[model samples]
Target: MKQKKSSQSIRWIIEVFLFIVAIVIFFGGLNHFWMRPVNSDLSKGNSQSRLTQKKFNYVAIGDSLTEGVGDRTAQGGFVPLLAHNIDDSYDVQVKSQNFGVSGNTSTQIYKRVTTDNKIQEAIKKADLITITVGGNDVMKVIRTQLANLSEKSFQAPAKAYQKQITDLFDYIRQYNPNVKVYVVGIYNPFYLNFPDIKQMQDVIDNWNNATKATVDKQKKMYFVPINDLLYQGLDGNEGVTEKTETSHTITNNALFEEDHFHPNNIGYQVMSDAITKAYKEHVNEK
Candidate 1:
């Protein structure tokens, strides 16, 4: 009876050991076949490096301006121009991706950056990023209050626009904290067309000011003021102010395309010049 009891005890110990070994193998196989591949794909999707080995990566985002809506060049708008210049001046190859959706509001742009996996990946890899938002946000308010325009009318939209701007930067930083961001200030496209509406000028200025303040607080971000570059002095506001004077003639109806809303090729050239100048100056300082 004693021998039989000892034999049974030894068999029970072997069964317990086998159970533990089976558990370990099951988890190991699950990780190797399922979990590891999922993790690897996520890393590749978010990788900042572009194919074919470029020296610099640029990501441009914003509204119609970003889309180069008025640009006659089939080659995209100011982004391509800026990319070319950067390549020549810096003597480095640049891979550029423009994620501009025509007529996009700040809120829409926020959604795109957060949800669009392709855009998120491009932004993550960007060495330099340029954003031109808030224009459509301003336009939305202007359209609503066209007849009943007032300084007070702008206050509400400005507040809302600020919130969207805050959210935009937040999303960008979440993806890539170290990339340089240049927030292109909104130009008064309506200044020449609707000069009599003095409140419009005030609205544009307020929007630019809000953007400047927001960008000032963050490192590796800058506010590129194109207001002065595009300002042609409408409705007796001011003829021209030489903030950062450019040689290009920005005024004249020819600068605007047929729509009278977007800039023509020459006008886009002026914008490209302003952005490139700002970039060069800022980079030199560093």
Candidate 2:
């Protein structure tokens, strides 16, 4: 009886070990497939400085959207285009440095503002600092909640979002008080609606308003409503249809990268135009 009991106990231990191995294999595979890309992007952005120090007139900073996820043109990105356009139009020697990275959120920018030596130098020297952030934060939340909750259910996180925005702006202001800061708001990606697109739109709108409120509290800080420029009706304006020549509307071919989140070439052009317009206005103010 003792030997039989021992054999049974050994068999049970083997089964438990096999079960644990199977669970690990299942979860490991899931992480490898689902989480790898996100992890890779985060790692790449957090690693090092890709931007060259050329003493640019303008510096663009933020996440993947600002990193030129779209745009097939090989001439760097929209920052170069905007600089060249400004140069050609205003007859000024305009140079730009792009400090954007893929998959960064406001938190990352906040960290970069505090830690990045190159960014600190650029901020001190730059005449214009245009930034596009907060999208990744909102996107990450949406992606996480989409599995179980309705898009509208994501609205409850507004307070947390506001805190992040406030913290990000506070960090930027603490770093450079006099720098011309333009905070681009988040734009809606789910315009076509697989789920509650309207709720997502509302969430983004509230986020933008929160950003604007932060900008309003600071001197020399401006909130550029790029989301409105892209998503027209969100601000009570007529929606731009395909007939509209505005660069805001994404052509089917110019979709973002594999993540289906960032902008393509056409989208980048729209963003460049918005930045150009804001910069021109800023210059005129001075």
Candidate 3:
């Protein structure tokens, strides 16, 4: 009986040891198959040596969006915000040159690139550049044809816009052979005021497509679409509101209440986020 008892005790100890070994093996396989790939992908996505550089220089040239027209803070809209984001995320010192002008059309911007010596110098030294054009170009066409507007009215202008954009890209490349360019797409801020005008959104979509097509032709150019980002105002966040005890009153409502044409503070934040994400993804894809 004593021998039989001792034999059973040894058997129990071996079974316990094997159970622990099985658990360890199962977890080891899980980590090998799952954890390693995740880590590898994160590293691969931003493995570019330049991205890891300690000092980053960002240059922004475009229209009011880059100028921060509607931003109450007067901090140069998405330009400063984007610089701040890059500073924190990449662990680098970002020196940004913002040359955003209000109500400047694509042609005007093209002209700036062609003539402005300061802008040219900035572009040459820039590690990264962001552009906010094509918005005023689209708006100009709309205002001209509003009396007899139709979807077809945009067709002719969009072609010209495309060429102008192509030229813009080519000129930038002329200055800097390797710096990446991010061109922001235009959105319809008038959608809320004129929801009945279904064709307006269509026109915006067409313009955005044209802008994206232009982006695709260049070597390292990327398009950041913020058309849907501002649409969230449709829910409860529409614009600035004044809450009253007696009445739920909306005194002023806009991503840009000052003009209802440009983006407000929140609007700029969304734009910066989108730009950052696009920048990261574009770099990764190349």
Best candidate (score: lDDT): 3
Per-model TM-score on C-alpha atoms = 0.72, 0.67, 0.75
The lDDT of model 2 is: 0.60
lDDT of each: 0.68, 0.60, 0.72
Best by TM-score: 3
lDDT of 3 by residue, 142-201 (tens): 557644556787899999989988988999999998998998888876544333345668
What's the best-to-worst order under TM-score?
A: 3, 1, 2
Clashing pairs in 2: 70-264, 71-264, 71-265
In model 1, where do residues sit more than 4 Å from their true spots?
Answer: 1-54, 233-254, 284-286
Model 2 CA RMSD to the hidden true structure, in angstroms: 14.8
Worst 10 residues of 2 by lDDT: 35-44
Clashes of each: 1, 3, 2
